[model samples]
Target: MTRDKILVVGANGELGQALLRELGTEKAIAATRTANTPHVGFDHVRIGSDGNLPVATLKRCAAVINAAGSVAGDDQTLRSANIHLPRVIALAAKNAGVPRLIQVSSFSILGAAEYIDRTTKERPINAYGRSKAAAERLLLESSSDELSVECVRLPFLFSATKPGLLAPLLSLTTRLRYLPTVAGNPVRRSMVVYADAAKQLVAAAQSGLSGISFVADPRPFDYALLATILAEEADINIRILQVPRPIAASIDHLLPALGRRLLRSSLLDPCANRVGDEPLGLEEELRKLVRSTYGS
Candidate 1:
């Protein structure tokens, strides 16, 4: 229980686990819903949903990163994860003498938009979005010098975990060698891979970054570029099929009800340089992913 530790909530999650690895066991103590032995080199503390995070768990922590959140579930579940949990964590962190709390939020807070800039505000078009936005508002209202709070709007991530959009897109590369370059697809959008996003979270927690900000890869990509990287790297053409931009975009429209939205080439902006000077390394990262996941 060193006083310099960081308590990472939801340490079992994709981003949370990455953060734990990035921060290392020496500085990180995992705070999870239930005690478990999954993470080998670190420590774990129970953070129950009772809105009562054990103060002792955070006592030694200089900061807390709320990687715990829900994107899909019933109304109660969403509200609990996105809203209640965050508010509770903030209170616990402040009380425990933790100096900073970095909350994990989603870009869904900006619901339907083709292009977004600094001027865009939260106009959530869905329940999940609304829930996340509400959580953010709660944190902002409570922020103070004693326990500075910051919410990071993490976008659809691309990683080996195959986060929502990447799962389908990466599926296409396992079996296809020849991919098409489409009109809408030079679509550089606001998205980042998991490891990069985790690093940004670490930076935010360490700096006690103020206000709400967005995170994304410094580089941009679309169907052809991503697909080529996978096919060339994996050398195994087995499982995914990428459609052209117009076709993919149309599919996105046709299934608005689908929980996982397809990656539309619509220009999604994550606010430039919000992630500082980290190189996105999209090509190399994807190549490694292909080898690890689909390569022989």
Candidate 2:
């Protein structure tokens, strides 16, 4: 009997690569815009310039996991990748009779919600968030008896292979004697290790549930605690300085570009809190991240 093929779009991306590693090469096919990518030794499909999945390729797969996304891009680029591409894929999957379509979405759509669940209303504050929210809406709305569509919303992800948002924090802790933070050290936002998140995405695809599902680490650490954990693990000491939120917000407003960058860093102020299965705790996650970046 032939094993069902799983086509992973944006297979070269961090989440896409994680899925490839989790699903293994035998059952997975990598789809990207360009054939030349770091992910080698796997079957690859090239996405067309028109942003449509090839029908022939779609028919050969059991399911299509769209991990394609962009955190940094202009409005047009964001919409094309985050919104248009997913819609195109959904339509193609339905037409090809693909049984399952899992879209990897982000927590950015939650905006400043303190707690997020399956029923939380999305309030996107920026172009990236807006695009993702729109994509999720489009895909979920398009689901029918013939096609199974679901969106797995993920929080900040870190892993040995992908440092993600941790890279900047690691740099700051090691380089700076003092790290500035909001006046009140806010609780750390929700996050999941890459491997765990990858497994969750695969599980969501296999499950029969439809609509939005969130995946995150069970326990979240605040900024100071996270820095302390990293510092201890790395054998480096750094001081934490608290700055007023209004002042920070003012600075951000004054320098719009810089503020946007900082907000993405998750260093500004905690907006939404994430809740999910925590296979690995904060310390363990930070330890793995530090080992990957600094070497034990």
Candidate 3:
């Protein structure tokens, strides 16, 4: 019997590579912009950053997982990758009769939508968030019941492979004039270990789960609490200041351009903060992140 063919766009990406490992030993095509080391169950294809994917090969695949994304530039490369690439994939999948397509999106889009003006609303205040939001919208608009198109809006992701949210925050702690104060807001957010997110993603693909789903930390906490935990692991003490929402919002506007410089590619671009509205086990995941980053 022929095994199902899974194609992973951006297969060389941090998340894509991890997801490839999780899928393990499947008949899959891993697409990247440059040559990469081959994995056991997959064949590597060097694709252009532009949407010049192998259409014929794509058609034969059973599912397509798009992890390709970008942020930065007067180029608006994000529009092509985040918006056009997915649309092309969807259309190709439809023609090829592929059953499902999973697009990875950012939680920031959800956060910034209500707060920012419409002109830049869809376009993230930060470059990265704009890319992700555009990609998510493209996926949603292109999908229908006939094809199983699902968007996985991920929050802050953590893993040993790279220093994530905690890294910069920990760095910030060192420079603080004083320990920041904890805020009382029960803001919802979700995060997942890269390995865990990969496992769930591959499993969901194989299981053929439909509709939109979010994989996040089962719990969420405010920044102050997060800093405290990091400080504990790092063997330092810290405090937090609770900036009121009005002040926070004002800052978000005043520093619109500051986002690209500070955030780069993170979900924490305060302008595009998409804290989860649903329950997510963020604390437990943070513990894992701390262990991985600081060592158990």
Clashes of each: 6, 1, 19
- Candidate 3 per-residue lDDT, tens place, 116-197, comes to 2112333344666766766666677767665688777666676644655557765665567243321443233335667766
> Candidate 1 deviates by what RMSD?
3.6
Q: For model 2, what is the error of residue 272's alpha carbon versus the real structure, in angstroms, after optimal superposition?
A: 12
Local accuracy of candidate 2 as per-residue lDDT tens digits, 1-296: 23388889998887888899988878788899986754677778898897777777788788899999788889999998999999998888898889899999888897755566556677887899899999988999999888888888887777756776568766765787666666764444667777777877888777787877777766664556656766777666677767688877886789865454333233212232223343455557777777667676
TM-score of 2: 0.83
- Most TM-score-accurate candidate: 1
Per-residue alpha-carbon lDDT of candidate 1 for residues 54-149, written as tens digits (9 for 90 to 100): 787788888999998887899999999889988888988888889999999888888766466656778888889999999988999999999898
Q: What's the C-alpha lDDT at position 70 in model 1?
A: 81
Descending-lDDT candidate ranking: 2, 1, 3
Pick out the ten consecutive residues of candidate 3 with the lowest summed lDDT. Answer: 259-268
Ranking by TM-score: 1, 2, 3
Name the runs in model 1 displaced over 4 angstroms. Answer: 161-163, 172-185, 234-253, 257-263, 266-271, 292-296
Which residues of candidate 2, in runs, are more than 4 Å off?
1-3, 179-185, 242-276, 292-296
Superpose all Cα atoms of candidate 3 onto the true structure and report the RMSD in Å to 1 decimal.
Answer: 5.7
Which pairs of residues clash in candidate 1, taking residues 3 or more apart in a chain or in different chains?
171-240, 172-240, 172-241, 174-238, 175-237, 175-238
lDDT for model 3, please: 0.62
